[model samples]
Target: MAVQSAPEKALETVGPPSAVEEGEDARVRKKKGTLQDRQDMWRIGREQELNRNFRFLSVLGFTAVLMCTWEAVMFGSQYGLLDGGAAGMIYTYIGAIVGFSAVILSMAEMASMAPTSGGQYHWVSEFAPPSCQKFLSYITGWVCVLGWHTGIAGCSYTVANMLIGILAINYPDSYVPQGWHGTLFVMAVASVAFIFNTFLAQKLPLIEGIILIVHCFGFFAILIPLWVLAPTSPPSKVFGSIEDRGGWGNNGLACLVGLVAPIYALIGPDSAVHMAEEIKDASRVLPLGMVWTLILNGTTGFVMLITYAFCLGDIDKLLEIETGFPFIQVFLNATNSVGAATGMTVIIMILQFCAAISNVATTSRQLYAFARDNGLPFSSFLAHVNPRYTVPLNALCTSLVIVCLLSLINIGSAVAFNAIMSLGVAALLSSYIISTCCLRLKRWRGEPLPPARWSLGRWSAAVETFAILFLLVVYVFSFFPLTRRVDAETMNWSVVIFSGVVLFALSYYFLYARKVYSGPVTRVKQLM
Candidate 1:
């Protein structure tokens, strides 16, 4: 008997192909019994749709901009300076990059094996025990959805506060930074992001590419001037200074609380993982994009931290500057010209705003993916994609509404808004812990996983274990209040809100979702 040619075999399996059937047959024949291959086969089978508009560089750019590492450090440095002082900030940042790298590496491996917009939840469903898969995946989805949604609010809030900071720089005594001002700015920033996501969706690749350029060179643009003109603190001051402004009593507790800033900066490298469906060769490209983005951003963030510490002149004056941003004050002092300082501040603001834009895009994709699995309140409408642009217009609008609603908390209490921001970090890390622990359990059971284009090989177990342990530490500290003393104004409400989200998800699952939701829907048939 002669072996059949590829086309002949496809025809035998799928029958004589019309134009559309012919393309489907080709994809079906290419399935190789791997998890990624199964996902592709499923997409073709179910007629699931997302245009593969991102190439490697574009995806990398998207991931890099989403991290916005140096920008985050600048925006969030106050926490570190207040709690850990210069020494604590510098050392904690280094520790965070190391710990976060482990988590990213583990996530990248799983991404290579099962690339999907469903991301952590999908991986959890695949690796979790059959008896609990539905419940586990359902809760994971909710956690991730809330995390990304709050992420949009958090990033936009940063942009909003920065804009106000700029205003305060120009207006000084007259420009009082109020809670309402931040809230209004958040609405404005989110609105712009919504317009870009809907009307200009097709241009995202180009936009991200340009933003990546700015994210990289913008570091040097700010750094060189500060280094050249700013009066430097002695090495002792930069490396050895430690303060307890948090009133935490114990210096150790203060340092632990300060870890939140750097950890939050590293949270969203997995943002690209949610765009798996939009990237060409997603299994390979997704992991590469994630790991490389971490490396690039982590390195630059560390260098930027050192520069800020060394160039930090009068700590007392910086803290008192009306800008609400220490870096802006540092820039002004370094240049000795408000004009140059404002120009540099504007550049950072642009990068931060670009980050908010990318945050909305990624968050909407996560929303669309969850809704497609019938996980949300109005799944049908929320999951609808605009055919012309192949973007989730409805989901984008829905996210905008939720973010705006959440921003309202800022008006009543900035401390409350801070809790919502903490929810983003805590919720995301919770999802990470669940998915990673599931993966580790599968490996420990000696179950076979599909071959990955990117593999950890002999180091898989060690890396996964370290990732889990490190994330557990970060998760615990994320809920700690910056100030030791508790007041309505100073209390950390993340624990309260995070617990509420979990309780609601569990209640909804038992009440309705368990009967209807069956983990991720298998839109494709098994190729074997």
Candidate 2:
């Protein structure tokens, strides 16, 4: 062999880059370019405070677990059974999926336009008329915040109830479930979310990735046994039966009330959108995360709904189960083993707790974003990002406080707590409706929108219109009492709660925020 100089030897040792390596290098460069492009488009300065630690799969996992659709469908099946019965769940679920598709697609396109932790409020700022941008954006921010807070409470309640449900199943004779017991569990559940979101923040993406497996595996784990071991209803009963157990007096009204179950199961696909600032190539990846989560969760949730409907045994008996959870009875009936049902229920409880963790993460980021814009009462404090963990510790704490307070309502009355939970869905839908209307108005006026990497093309007009209209319809129905003979326990207080928040936001705006606060759009250098 010929003698070689030091430089020549080093080159030979390193070797040339392969095609695969070069391709990957190009992709990485493209990703950086996209991120920079998005930042420049948004024209905001504080993008670096939170870490971009999430990628596509992790984000998808975060949203999938956050939605926990199939599990929610089961948890919420009783209301559907009471009004719409087996066939009603099947049909309304189908309709809700179709209607919600428009809302998700519309929101997805806007997310691509401005992927930020502010979510609907951010979009409202960008898309609304300049004259009303400040007011609309501020109101949207508050409503969005209200929505997420209620969402945290709702998730914690689910975990708490499931835990108590397990205890009631195993120790029925001794465990006379007290309302305070569930409240204590709710506190514990909220604490878990706060700890993970604040202390283990770095591990969230990895945790979510792993939990995604459990999400799917648990689906099959509970599903296979139900299909194999449970008694099945005939096709006619499963597909065509409808009941008006709520005494709504008409099949149409009963079905409408039942639609709440499916809609609630599907509402939070935007969980990924609220984490946009913490995702690589967020403008593109965020929309994909939201869309795919919805598709996957919807498909699986629908399948599970059909399965549970068929295996429901006796609806009245399941409803009367001391655990206060119909799904526990379904699992028990299917497996015919207390241990087996406990195991399956534990999987659901675990995933729900996981969802609560993700909920806290998203809710904190959202509150932090609004506070950064001086939209909240304690704007500076709530916006603080912990220097050590690079997480919004203060925001997380605030969310925890609100969650605990909301859960405290459970001790007063389960019906009241449910009403608070229902407010979450209504508030979120209101935010959607406002943002979609703003986008549609801007489009009609021929104004330039922020360039969208994931545009809906010509379908944008039709999709946005349908989203607004469908959302409005759902919002109206969401406030109606399940039965016409409305009483304190049976009445839907969502509208009251929603109106109160809006009134508070409006009052606070004129009283304080209006003087110091501007919409997020005003912070955009390019727009200015």
Candidate 2 lDDT, tens digit per residue, 1-528?
113323234434432223223354653443333544345433543435667778999999999999999999999887788778889988999999999999999999999888888888888887888888888989989988999998888888888888888888899888778888878888899998899988899889999999999999999998999999998989988888888888989987899987778888999989888888778888888889989998999999999999999999788787677776798988888888999999999999999999999999999999999998899999999999898998989999999998888777745344755576678888898899999999999999998887788889999999989888888888887777666778878888778878887898889999999997777766544332
Looking at model 1, report the run of 10 residues with the lowest lDDT sum. Answer: 1-10
* Residue 381's lDDT in candidate 1: 99
Measured against the true structure, the TM-scores of the candidates, in listed sequence, are: 0.91, 0.92
- In model 2, the runs with Cα more than 4 Å from the true position are 1-38, 45-47, 412-414
In Å, residue 337's CA in model 2 sits off its true spot by 1.0
Per-residue alpha-carbon lDDT of candidate 1 for residues 2-70, written as tens digits (9 for 90 to 100): 133232344235521222333545334332223443355343232336666777788878988888898
The count of residue-pair clashes in candidate 1 stands at: 0
Cα error, residue 20 of model 1, in Å, equals 10
Note the residue pairs that clash in candidate 2.
none
Query: Candidate 1: misplaced stretches above 4 Å?
Result: 1-46, 412-417, 521-528
